[model samples]
Target chain A: MIKLNSNLMIHQYFCLMIRYLKKQNFWFVFTPYFWLVLFFFIPLALIFKISISVSEWGMPPYRDLFSLSEEGFKIDSTLSNYLFIFSDPFYIRSYLNSLSLAFTSTILCLVIGYPIAFYVAKSHANIRIILLVLLIIPFWTSFLLRVYAWKVLLQGSGIINSILIHLGFITEPISMLHNHYAVILGVVYTYLPFMILPLYGYLVKFDLNLIDAANDLGAKPVNTFLKVILPLSLPGIIAGSMLVFIPVVGEFVIPEMLGGSDKLYFGKIIWDEFFVNRDWPVASALAMSGIVILVFPIVIFQLMYAKYNFKNE
Target chain B: MQNTILRMNKLFFKIFTLTIGFSFLYFPILTLIAYSFNDNKRVMVWKGFSFRWYKELFQNEQILEAFYTSIKIASLSATFATIMGVMIGFSLTRISKIPARPFFIFLSSSPLVMPEIILGLSLLLFFISSNHIIGFPSSKGQLTVLISHITFSVAFVAVIIQSRLSSYDKNIEEAAQDLGTIPNMIFWKITAPVILPSIISGWLLAFTLSLDDLVVASFTTGPGANTLPIVVFSKVRLGLSPEVNALSAIIMLIVVLAAISVYFINRSHIKK
Candidate 1:
C-alpha cells in the first residue's frame, strides 16, 4: 500500500510541474512584451497620429483623429502640420542649423578624441586603467554642471577673461556667454567622451603585430596607419560618430543655456511649438521629422556594417 | 639617428595629446570646484576661500527636497527597470518560441538610441491620452516621471543583462538540469549568481540615468515632482549660483568615491 501511494505522488508531481512550466513560458514572454508594447511602441505610434491630426485651439490643442459624431464614422486627419513645417523658412533654417551643428561638433570631437583614445589604448596596462577611470569620472558627473562650469569660465569677469587681461592679450573683457560658438563649444565638450569611449574600445582590442608587419613589409608609418589601422577602426569611428551625431542634432539644454536668439535649432523649435506656442501637432511633426532624419542613416550604416563584417570574416 | 629622432617625435606627440586631452576634460570641473569656495556671491569673482555656499546649500529646503525626490524616484525606477530587464533578457536569450521576436527586439532596442526629447515628448503625450481614455494616474507627478524613467532605462539594463547572459557558458545550466535540478532551481541557484554583477551594474546605470535626466523629467513632471537637474537648471538657466557650485562639488566627490569603491571591489573579485 505504501509503495503504490509513493508512485501516485510522483506522477501527480510531474503533472503539476509540466503545467507550471507551460504557464511560466507564456507569462515570462508576455509580461515584458506587454509592458513595452503598451508603454514604448504605443507612445511612438501616438506621435504619428498626433502629427497628422488637425490643429485647433483647445485643451488638448488638436482635433481628435477619429471621433464619433452625428456623421457616422468620421476620420479627421490632415498633413497640414508637416506641410506647414516644410513651408516655413523658420523651420527649414532650424533643421539646417541643427544638422550643421551636429556635423561640426561630430567632426571636432573626432579630431580631438581620436588621438586621445589611441594613446590611452596604447598606454601601459596600469596607466591605462587609471586614465580610463579619470575619463569616466567627468562623464559620470552631472552634465548640466559641466556646461555651467563653461558658462562661468566664459563670463565677462570669469577666469578666462581675467587671465587673458592679466597676460595683456586683451585690455577689456569680451562677451562670450551666449553665441553659436559657445553652443558648439558646449556640445563638443560634453560629447567628446561619447566619441572617445567607443574608439578606445576598438583600438584596445587591435593587435600591434599588424603595424609591425606593415613596417617590416617596407610600408611607411602614414601608409600603415591609413591602410591598416584606419580601415580596421572604421567601425569604431562610425560608432563614435553615431553616438555624437544623433543626440547633438536634437540637443536642447546646451543650446538653451549657451546659445543666443540669433540661432535656433530643431530641439528648441519642437520645445517652443509645444510649450510656448501650444501647437501639439506641429511639435509632433517636428519630432517625427527628427526621428526620420536620424534613424534612416543609422539603419543604412548598420546594414553596411553587418555586410562589411561578413565579407571581412 | 633616424630611429632616435622618430622615437622622440612619437613620445612628444603622445605627451602633447594626453596633456591637451586631460586638461580639456578636467579644467572646467576643477574650475567649478575651486570657485565653490569663493566668498563672493558672483561665481566668477574669487574674493577668498570660505564654506559659505556649502553651508547655504545644506539649509536650503527647496534643493534638499528636490534631492530627496530625485533619490526616491531613481531607486524605485532602477529597481523596477532591473526586474523587467532581467525578464526580457532571460526570455530573449533562453526561450526559443517567443511570439514576434523581431518586434520584441525592436521595442527593447530602439529606446537605447532614441533622442531624449522625443522620448520625453512621446511619453508626455502617452500619459495625457491614457488619462483621458482610462481616467488613470489622475495627475502627472513623481509617478509619471518614474514610469518614463523605467520605460527608457529598461532597454539599458536589458542590454547589459543580455550581453552577460550570452557570454557565459550554458553547459553548467544543462548539467544542473540533467542532475535532477528543476528549471526554476537552476535559474535561481546558477544563472542568478552568474549574472548578479551585471544586474547590480545595470541597476546602478539606471539609477544614474534617472538622476541625471533633465529633459524627460521636465516633460513628465508636474507639481511637487521637481528633480535635482530641473531645480539646478532653473537656478542656473538665466544666471549662475554659488550654492549650485557647492552642490556640484559635493556631487563630484560622491561620484568619485563611489567609483573608487566599485573599482576596488572589481579588482578584489579579479584577484579571487
Candidate 2:
C-alpha cells in the first residue's frame, strides 16, 4: 500500500512537469518564431510578390502588385519576368553552367576528399586530433583570402608560371588566372574541408574490424571496399555532397574572382540582373525559379526520407 | 611474406594520401604567409624579407576601421544569435507541444540550405522595403548588417544546440523537477551547464560566419559600414595588395592559435 502511494505521487509529479512544460512552450517558441516569420519567411514571400510585379521606371523599380489606379482595382501582375528568364538562352545557359559546375566540383571534392578523410580517420589516435585541428584551421580562415591565394599563385608573372617555365613544361607563361579550370580548382580547394569533415565523422566511427572480417572471408580489397566500406559510408557521402553541392550551385565569389567572360553562372546572372541591369522583377523571378528548382525537390526528398525512416522504425 | 608486402603497400598509400592532402590544404596558406614578408611592392617577386607591409597595414586607416567594424558586428551578432538559437533549440527538443512545429523547423533549417546570394538579395530587399514603409533605419549601415548576420546565424547555432540538447541525458532535469525545484531554476542548474560547450562553439561559429561574410555584407552595407572583407576585396579586386597579405598572415596566425588552444582545452577537459 505504501509503494503504490509513492508510485502515485511520482506519476502526479511527472504530470505536473509535462503540463508546466506545455504551457511554457509558447513563451520559448514565440520570440524566434516571430523573428523568423518577420525576417525570413516574409522576405521570401516579398521576393515572390516582386517577381510577379510589372517592371516600371521608378524608385522601387517595379510597379506595386495591387495598384489603386482608375482601372477599378486591377492587379498589375505579370508572369513575363519568369517568361523572360525562360525565353532567353543566356539565362538558361547560365543555369546549366551552375548545375554542371556544382556537379563537377562535388565529384572532384569527393574523389580528392575521400582518401584524405579515410587516411585521417585511419590514423593513430594521437595524430587524428591534430589532423582534425589542421583541417579546421583553413576552414575558419577568411574564404576570400583563400580564393585570393589562388589568384596570386595563378598570375601571369606568378610562381606557378615561373615554375612551369623553369621546368620547361611550357615555353611561355600560360594564362591560368581567369578560366573555368581555375574556378573549378578554387571551388574544390575551398569546399574540400566541408566534404572531408562529414566523411571523417562517419568514417571515424566505422568499424575497421569489418575490413578484416571481409578479408578473412576471402574478399579481395576492391570487393571489400565496394561491398562493405562504400555501402556503410553512403550517409556520410550524401551529407558531404549536400554540403558541397548546394552552395556551389549559387557560388558567386569564387567564380567572380577566378572565372573569365567565357562562362556565366546562375549566381553571377542574378547578381547582374539586380545590380547591373537594376531589374528587380527579373532578379526576383530568377531567385524564385532557383528556389523552385533547387529547394523544393530537396524538401520533398527530405520529407519522403523521413516518412520512409518512420515506417521502418 | 605476402602479408608483409601488403602491409607495406597499405602504409605507403596512407602516407602518400596524407601528404598530398595536407600539402594541397596548406600550400597556398603557407605561400601567402611566406610572401607577407616580401620587401617589394609586388607580392610575388623575390626580395629581402622585411616587415614593410605589416608596418604599412598598421598605418592604413580604411582597413583598420573596417577591421574594427567587422569585429564589433561579429561579436554582437554572435551573442544575440546564440541566445535566440538556444531558445529555438530548447523549444524544439525539450518542449514537445510547439504549435506549427513543422513550419518552425522549416524556418530554422531552411537558411542552412539557402544560397548566400539569394539570402543576401532577399534580406537587402526586405530592409529596403521596410525602411521605405516605416521611415525608420533611415539609412543602411552596421545595424542592417547585424540583423542579416543574426538572421542566418541563428539557424546554424540552433542546429548545434539542438543536436547537443538531444544527445544529452534528460534525467537530471526530471530529477530536479521531482525534487520540487521550479522550472527556470531547474533549467539554469541542470540543463545549461550540460550544453555550455555547445553554446560556446555555436557563438564561435556564428562569429566566424559574420567575419568571413562578403556577399551578404556587400548587398546590405551602405557607406561607413564597410567590413574587413569589403576592404580586402576592393584592394585586391584589380590586383594583389601586399598589405592585405600582411592582414591574412595576422588573421591566419590568430585562427591557428585559437584552434590549438581549443584543442588543448578539450583535451584537458577529457582528462579531468
Candidate 3:
C-alpha cells in the first residue's frame, strides 16, 4: 500500500534479514542442536570410533583409528575387543549379574513403591502435597548420603544389628553389609522415589469413581484394583520399571559401597577396565555393548509401542 | 453393624500399610540424623550426646573446599544448562519446522536415561581426543567437569521446560499478535513471563543434579577439581566417619528447606 522504490527494496530486504536473525524460533532450534551435536552425539561417535581401535600401551592407551602404514591407505581397526569381551567368563558373568540385579531390584521397587504411591495418591488433596513434598525432600538430599544411610544400617556393628541384638532376634550380628542383598537394598532405597513419582503421576489423575462403581457392582477390593486400577496404571508401571532397571544395570557406586565380591556389574567392569586395567579399548567396547544390551531393547519396545498406538489411532 | 465393622477393619489395614511404608522410607533418614549427634569417633558406638563431630566438620578444610567447588560448579553449570535447555524445550513444543527433529529429540532426551558411567567415560575420552587434536582444554579440571555436567543436566532441564511449554496456552500469544504485537515482543513479553516458573524450576533441578553427580564427575575430574560427592564417596568407601554424618545432616536440612520453598512457590503459582 505504501511506496515501492529501489531504496525501499534494499531497506525491506535488510529488515527481513535482521528479523530472521532475531526470531526466537530460529535461535531455539539452532542453539540446542549445535551444542547437543557437538558435545553429546560427537562424543558418543568418538567412543564408537575408539572402541573399534586396537588396544595398545601408550598415552591415550589405544591405537589410532586410521594410520598410514606401508600400505597406501590403512584403516587400523579390530573387532577383537568385542570378541575378547564376549569370550571372557568374568565379563559374561558380570553382564549376567547386572541383569539379575536389575531385575530383582526392579521387582522389589514395584512391590514396595506401588503401595506407597497409591496411598499418597489416595490421600486428601491438602495432605497429598505435604506427603509428596516429604517424598521429594529425601530424593533431593545427597544420593551418596542416602546410600551411606544403608551402610550405617547394615554394618556389622550398625543399627540393624544393634536393634536385633537388643530385641533378642539374634545373638550374633549377621553379616549384612557386604553382600549381594545389601546392594539390592541400597538400589531399592535410593531409586524408590524414581518409581513412586512416576506411578503417582499416573495414579493421581485416575478417576476414583470407577473404583466406587466397581465396588457397587459387587467387585471386591482386590478385584477392583486388578481390573480398574492396574490396567490404567500399566503405562506408569512400565515407565517406572524401565527408569529403575536401566540405571541399576549400569550402577557402580551402590555395589562398591554395599556389595561384596559375591557379584559384579557391567558398570563396575567398565570402571575397572578404564582405571584399574587402563584398557580404553575394552572399556569403550564394554560401554558400546552396554548400549547394545540395554538400550537396544528399550528403543525397540518404544518404536513398536509408538507404531502400535499409531495403528490403533 | 457388620458393614461398619468391615469398614473400620479396612481403614485400619490401609493405615497400617501406609505407616509401614512411610516408616521404611523415613527410617534410614532418621538414623543418619541421630548418628550425627553421636559423640564417639566410632559412628556406630554411642559414647554420649555431644557436638564434637559437628565442631570438627566446621573446621575441616577438605570438606569445606569440596563443598565450595560443588556450589560454584553447580551454579555455573545450571545457568548455562538452563539457557540451552529452554531453547531445546521451546523448539520441541512451540515450533514445528525444526530440521532433524527426531534426532534432536533423541540427543536431548537420551541423557536422562543413559548410565552415568558411560556418559562420563565418553566425555572424558572426547575431551582427551579434543585436547590431543586441538590445543584447547589441555587439562581436565573444573572447566571439563562443568562442560560434562551441563551436557547431561541440559536434558533434565529441557524435560521440565518441555512439559511446561507443551501444556501452555497458545491463544494468549495469538491474541497478542492480533493486537499488532511483533513476534519477538510477544515471545519476550508473554512467553517469557508464562514460562518463568519453569525456567526457575529447571535451573534449580539442574543445580541439584550437578551437585549430586558423583560417578560422572569422578570420571571427568582432575587432581584439583574434587566435588563434594567424590570427596564424600572416597571417605565413606574406606570407612564411616562421624564428621561425614554431621556434614550429611547439614546437607539434608538445606535440601529440605529448598524443596519446601519450591513447593510453596509452585503451589502459589498453580493457585494463581
Q: Return the interface RMSD of the candidates, in order shown, one decimal each.
A: 4.8, 3.9, 4.1
lDDT of 1 by residue, A1-313 (tens): 9999999988886787567567667677567767788888899899999999999888799999999988888899998999999999999999999999999999999999999999999999878888888888888898899899999989999999999999999999998989999999999999999899989988999998999999999999999999999998888898789888988888999999999998999999998988999889999999999998888756754554334322311
lDDT of each: 0.89, 0.89, 0.87
Write the residue-wise lDDT of candidate 1 on B88-195 in tens digits. Answer: 888767765454455566667677678889989999999999999898779999999999999999988987888788778878999999999999899999999999
Q: Can you give the lDDT of residue A169 in candidate 1?
A: 94
Query: Model 3: per-residue lDDT, tens digit, A85-197?
Result: 99999999999999999999999999999988988898899889988998888788888999999999898899999999999999999999889999999999999998999
Model 1 residue runs over 4 Å out of place are A1-24, A300-313, B96-100
In terms of TM-score, which candidate is strongest?
2
Interface RMSD of 2: 3.9
B48-118 in candidate 2: lDDT tens per residue? 89999999999999999999999999999999999999998887787665444566677777777788898
Comparing to the true complex, what docking class would candidate 1 get? acceptable
User: In candidate 2, which residue pairs clash?
Assistant: none
Each candidate's clash count: 0, 0, 0
Q: Per-residue error at B174 for model 1, in Å?
A: 2.7
Q: List the residue pairs that clash in candidate 3.
A: none
Candidate 2 off by > 4 Å: A1-22, A300-313
